[model samples]
Target: MVTSQSTESRPSLDYEAVIGLEVHAQLETESKMFCSCSSGYVNSPPNTHVCPVCLGMPGVLPVINRKAIEYTIMTGLALNCTIAEQTKFDRKNYPYPDLMKGYQISQFDQPLCSQGWLTIQVDGVDRKIRLNRVHLEEDTARLVHKDGPDGERYSQVDVNRSGTALMEVVGEPDLRSAEEARLYLVKLRTILQYLGVSTGNMEEGSFRCDANISIRPVGSQDLNTKVEVKNMNSFRAVYRALNYELERQIRALNEGERIVQETRGWVEAKGITVSQRSKEYANDYRFFPEPDLPPMVIDRAWVKEIRDRLPELPDARLARFISQYGLAPNDAVVLVNSKPMADFFEECVALTGDSPKVEPGQRARAVGTWMLGDFSKLLNAQGMEIRESKVSAEALSEMLGLIDNKTLSGKMAKGVFEEMFDTGKSPGRIVKEKGLLQMTDSTEISGAVAQALESNPDAVSDFLSGKEQALTFLVGQVMKATRGRANPAMVNSLLRKQLESRK
Candidate 1:
């Protein structure tokens, strides 16, 4: 059996690390935050999706996007944050090429949401990670650096991504280990996907994270110098970066070196973090209220409407899968991790009549097995998601129905499934086309069984001499003779009857 690695196995480190994450999720809004430019500029040429307000042209009055605010409020409510009755945007002044207007429109003293918490389970134990705030801000333009013809480095600014709606989720320093940090991010992404505000695709740059990690002595409450790690594009990168940072900080303290507060970038190829620059304090941004946009006044009815529209989240869905379907907790977790995959699984189950004739627990177990087993393997091999798979949910349900009704044996179904996954054919059609149905006909199976007994008399003698395993060997011979299409239980019964008759 497999086991989880235990922390106690390693040498105990006297210090503990405090970790907090700032996740920025680009909203799925069509237009720019303050202008009419399209935000869907992924593959479009740089600078094509620009306008007066987004391009930092002078005297352009900025207007807020209503859908952006509603999305932020919806996410805030999903995170259990309190919506501020009065909130407004502020100017965060910074000098960077990405900041088109020499500043970013963000929130300061009055953010739209505050004081929410999310619960994460680590090592089978539940822990609540507090949220400091969930705020909204306009995204900056992307900076593309390339090498010139002579190997000289030059940077180009693409304003196509400028002024996009970006929501920031700031978490408390509640995480202690890298595993907990990963779990927190995964849970956060699931929530965002369910909210449908963001795609939560890290590789596509829609969802990004910056981690602030600091190591301190155990049982001490005082904070220490923290380094912010950035440019982690995936969950694995984030986990590895944090763990590497933890080791680096712990080693520095052991060598009598002081830690410095700075911003670092994750070097994925080097498997380490390199210091980029000194970390900036909040005052450095020089935040001030935005003059052009008016303050937002949210009312009770608005909050209630958004809250009522909230769909079921991961935790609740996990519980329902366990209690209603009688699935194991771990199985429920895998099913509920991805919203689309979970929906597909449910659709397959619904098509099977949920196996009404069979035991509900048995039927649920079978469905979960196929999903987490061969189906998952195929998806991984092709590097595609369930929605992208050639086999539809209806096709898989038909295959499972055949197994439940004994129309196809388990071994035969495996081959039929492979054909379906490759050819996008229905399970029934593949079975019929390939003549892969089980040999339930007594006459066909009996002929194969008699031939096996005649050729394997030595094995039959062993069975009579009280070797119970000899019976299994003879049964395998019969299955092999029938090309694995024979009903295994019937073959075993016939083999026993023929051997007893020889006595």
Candidate 2:
């Protein structure tokens, strides 16, 4: 197995890490879900994308966007849900400034999809998590709270986000570890991306999740009071927040403090959860029927159409990696995590032509190392993706060509590859330009070895006296004399020969 390195080991805590996620994705539709206004509210001025219908003006009507409905169905299908052919929206009546119509058009009793499951790898083992439901709803408008006259607080509303289409996916509390929670999110985002349902960009508010985390004693049957965590942006944030909250809850239980069911905000700076509002009850949000909208009627034929258009998901790709490329479990996990990187590897494999230099399995390992190490370092520094990188798969294969043929030392090939990454030029061009090609010729390296032998007579004697480590010291000297251009393997081999010939 390919070993993935991280700073911290899995925690051996006394309690279990129980987590459930509620992901909200803003649908990328051309128009608002309920009105004929633009749905792309982000980056626009306040109230710009609003309309009379979205503003809840009297005597206005609402209509559903066909594309938004299709996307929602597609998302439901990808999540492996059974689409309810005849789904309708109920008004979640909550009087707030964000709700211009005093209610949100949401699916409650009749959701679009139900009873789905997604499989994620946890600690090298695949585990399945059931999806409770995927529902469609109209987004609430933005609220700006500020100080007003008479020392009272007032709320200003922006209707831009109002009526924007939103799809919510609720996961069962099948997650039992921090890593499982992370894998679940990655798998969920992958499905969304493949369906083209949402951008899955947490920073842009297009894709976001609220995690419900509660911990109990290991093997305990009683469920602890759950705390809802909000304001987590990235997958790492979800993982870390759950981890920290799990510890805090365990400590509280051990100290005999009763855990309360409440909503909390993630303090990313402090890596902890802070108290927010008390968790709302069902009765708190008074429910009613929207008078302006009509119930939606879907059919089996439409759900089947959406299922037929489902895209390949992460588990499918991971299986392909293992069966076709013979990649180990860890290797497959890393590659499948980044779609662009996986696509790059596929392109390069196709370009290798007949009679590849190595077997498919070995080549997959090589590609994984390159992508995980050198390529990853550069990408992390530049903040770029494999798809946007200047270097192509063909270029990387050419660099591998030099290394496999012993023309470029691993150290020298590192230099060539770095230059190739920056310049997007061929490996040969970089080697020729910088003279980094391996000096494997016996004459040149031997001459440098001879100089090292002369400069360190005691080291040569130590090697002759069977000090194996001393031979490495002499090789270091020779490598320095050659300005790091010496082929390390050849130098080691020749050093053994010369020292053996002595005494």
Candidate 3:
């Protein structure tokens, strides 16, 4: 929370806000957490993917999915958490229509991972946001509200999402602003995607976030009454929600209104948070150990094996992109943001051989430029991802090679690349088929220069009068005559020679 500075005659008001996020990331396991039902329930028919165990039928024992546990460990390790030597499940008792099991089987006192921290940079300054715990739990069913005939409101249950392997990452209340919170979520999503654990798609509800926000006096260490904000399905929504909450709290305090502890849902359509219910404390959930599950001991060797297999994370890869490829830090950041984009860049560089004729660093820069420039532009315009594009790394590298060796003009290469992007044709074949080969012949350029000098006497006179821009106009005319196939450097030299010879 922040307060407006007041005049010296008036009392100055200032405050600080504490924000913590509990993010639930659905694990990319094929089966549900405690059942064998298919986890691929997106767009599926209602209740089509449920099982007796997931539906809370009696007399069925639950068996945990091993892959889900491995994913949890991988996620925890990636976030710099310490794995517990012993962990087990607890029954979190809460009666909700969405929860099939009257109670949710989640970790309570002993979670799988604890004491982790994630680093996020804001305004070029890095901050380490600590993690309180990372625990595993099962997702509940989805409720769909519908409007019936005569304008009656009805509710439907969709158990297809029930029993999915959902893992929670609880962060400490260290975030100061909405921007910081957004960065934290973005970095966390990147790590999860890099580890190949979760898709991190919020639109489909695969990744969800709940924010705990409170505001206190600027220097006070005592915690203030906090509000839990939910229904923020996207990163933008989360930022907006927190900002709205901050302003709301400040306004309340200024008007002598008390900030009540409650649960609120972000009405995205309205761009405001509306109160939903009184906030539930820990005692409201009545947590106890699950009698059906057994506590298991985690061996040190197993944890070490997972640690050894962790992939090179985003921060490390960004550094390598700068040092190994000689890329600027800004370019490196854009390239390494997405794993696919980073992979595509490396593949293109590998295809451009390290021959004495061409420097690898130059090639890397070329590939990065195209990727961040025209390639990105076309992808955005067409609403397609790099992985979904028709152009392959081999084809793009080949196109760059053509421009490097003067086989194609830079302008011609752009057209050839566009064709390759659309038709998946080889750059060589496209250039050949379109007759777009660079015109480096001095004779052809000499004729175009003569035509331009004769046609634009004003520009030629201007050049002779020491107007340097006149020379550029002559070169543009020559390039246009050749349909942009003429080498620009050759055009410039030829145009200058003809003009100077006349003078």
Question: Cα lDDT of all candidates, in order?
Answer: 0.88, 0.81, 0.90
Ranked candidates, highest TM-score first? 3, 1, 2
Query: TM-score for each prediction?
Result: 0.94, 0.86, 0.94
Clashes in model 1: which pairs?
none
Q: lDDT winner among the candidates?
A: 3
Report the CA-based lDDT of candidate 3 relative to the real structure.
0.90
For residues 163-235, write the lDDT of model 2, one tens digit per residue.
8999999999888877788888888887787677787888777888998888765777566689899989888
Off by over 4 Å in 2: 1-17, 35-48, 142-159, 277-283, 289-292
Clash total of candidate 1: 0
The pairs that clash in candidate 2 are: none
Cα deviation of 239, candidate 2, in Å:
2.7
Poorest stretch of ten by lDDT in candidate 3: 4-13
What tens digits encode model 1's per-residue C-alpha lDDT throughout 1-503? 01122253344457777999999999999998888899999999999999999999989998889889888899898888999999999999988899999999999999899999898988798999999999999999999899999999999999999999999999999988777889999999999888889989988899999999998767889789999999899999999999989888887766667998888999999999999865355448878889988998988898888889988988898999999888899988988888888888788777766446877767767888888999999999998888988889889888988887787889888888888899999999987887878889888888898999899989989999899999999999998888788998899888888889987
lDDT of 2 at 456: 97
TM-score of 2: 0.86
